[model samples]
Target: MTRWVGPWLLLTCVFLLMVGNVDPWNVLVGAGVAAALLRWSGRWLMDGRPPGKLGPRRVWGFGVLALAVLADVVRGTWRMMHVILGPSPGAKQGVVEVPLGERTEGGARVSALVASMAPGSVLLDIDWERRVMRFHMVDASRADEFRADMERFYRERQRAVFP
Candidate 1:
């Protein structure tokens, strides 16, 4: 009924996109396929949990978080360029563990993705039981600074968007 309309339209669009055609025949085929999937894949698609609401506030927060991540990427790239092109005698590359406090799985995943986008850093692992994230950094000497930065980001930026 009305509940399935959005998924049906989305899946139909996906089908048309994958097939790269928009003729009447393709549209009909896409709609049929979308209907069949929606009919059979309800449990698989949603599990038992209800879908999360997406309000305007959350959308705006997400946009702000994206811009913040981009800024981090640019700054990291500039710092990495210096390390790469010139002699960085102070640089110490290694892994640093940062406390992940009480983040939900989705929030932690987003943090990992955004953290990894910064140049010269990679998210190595998320230790759920330990409540920590391990990141490999080009300059482990700044581990304390890195941890502080991450804490600030999680508190100020990601908390609103993902929490």
Candidate 2:
């Protein structure tokens, strides 16, 4: 049965939002416009099928990251100054290859974000085929220890938010 349902509902919303005038003439005009749009949509877009449910928690994840990045920026500035000027705390400098997860895109982003935000670590590159993130970290005398620390930090904070 061809009846005015979805398009009229949408047009009602639009007309009410645009102009509070509710009269027969306005209703007729709005219905005409809405029906034209519905016809166009039927031809060009999906045939009135509802879209998939989008994830709502993505914004909250972003909020969590905004705060974390702010803290990291301030702390990193201080740490960088210390590393450059203050007495040596035995900051290690080398390429520490850390094995990554199978989730290529997410794992790479997490590794880069965490490494760049941490005190003295920078993600140099990520090898997708090898599933490893090559990073440059400071203040670690051992590569294994540094990789463990990175993995632990991600599990504690990043995983909680992103995963």
Candidate 3:
């Protein structure tokens, strides 16, 4: 039952988001489709595994993390615009290795998603053995600052949510 809950909730959210409105008929149809998809997919998506406990602290942490990610997205967009409009015709791009504090697969995936969602950064590779993520950044000069920010995010925001 616990194993089913996560998938159902995820699928339901996806369905609702896809439909984009709360019409009763739309919700009914979306639920049906979500259920069908979940049943057909079986446990392949999560391998019958339940997620970590979502206690109050973790939930709060998740909310904060979401807001932080949103802020990063906005900031990154503005920085990209500046880079494009500024005198610098060609910005230096390079890959930097950022060490990970949260080394779990889920944590790594979330970190990758967050990093890549921002305009200036893309995750190039994950060094599992070394517990580092290689990210290609638009401005190589800010690599140290970006690495510090990522570390701070994981330490302050993501540990509770992903641990």
lDDT for each of the candidates?
0.84, 0.64, 0.80
For model 1, the local distance difference test gives 0.84
TM-score against truth, every candidate: 0.67, 0.50, 0.69
The backbone clash count of each candidate, in order, is 0, 2, 0
Q: Write the per-residue lDDT of candidate 3 for residues 42-109, one digit (tens) a residue.
A: 54455755448768987888899999999999999998888778788346888999887755776776
Better of 1 and 2 by lDDT: 1
Q: What ordering of candidates by TM-score runs from best to worst?
A: 3, 1, 2
Q: Which stretches of model 1 miss by more than 4 angstroms?
A: 1-51, 88-91
Give every collision pair in model 3: none
Q: Give the winner by TM-score.
A: 3
Model 2 / residue 107 / CA error / Å: 3.2
Write the residue-wise lDDT of candidate 2 on 23-135 in tens digits. Answer: 88888787786776565345323354422223656556556766766776787678667777857654556677887853335545655766677667777777877888887
lDDT of 1 by residue, 37-153 (tens): 676456546455433467898889889999999999999999888878867643588999988876777677678878889997888888889989999999888889998998899
In model 2, which runs have C-alpha deviations exceeding 4 angstroms?
A: 1-54, 88-91, 117-119, 142-149, 160-163
Q: Once all C-alphas are superposed, what RMSD does model 1 give against the true structure?
A: 9.0
Displacement of residue 22 (Cα, Å) in model 3 is 26
TM-score of 3: 0.69
Per-prediction CA RMSD (Å): 9.0, 15.8, 7.2
lDDT of 3 at 135: 92
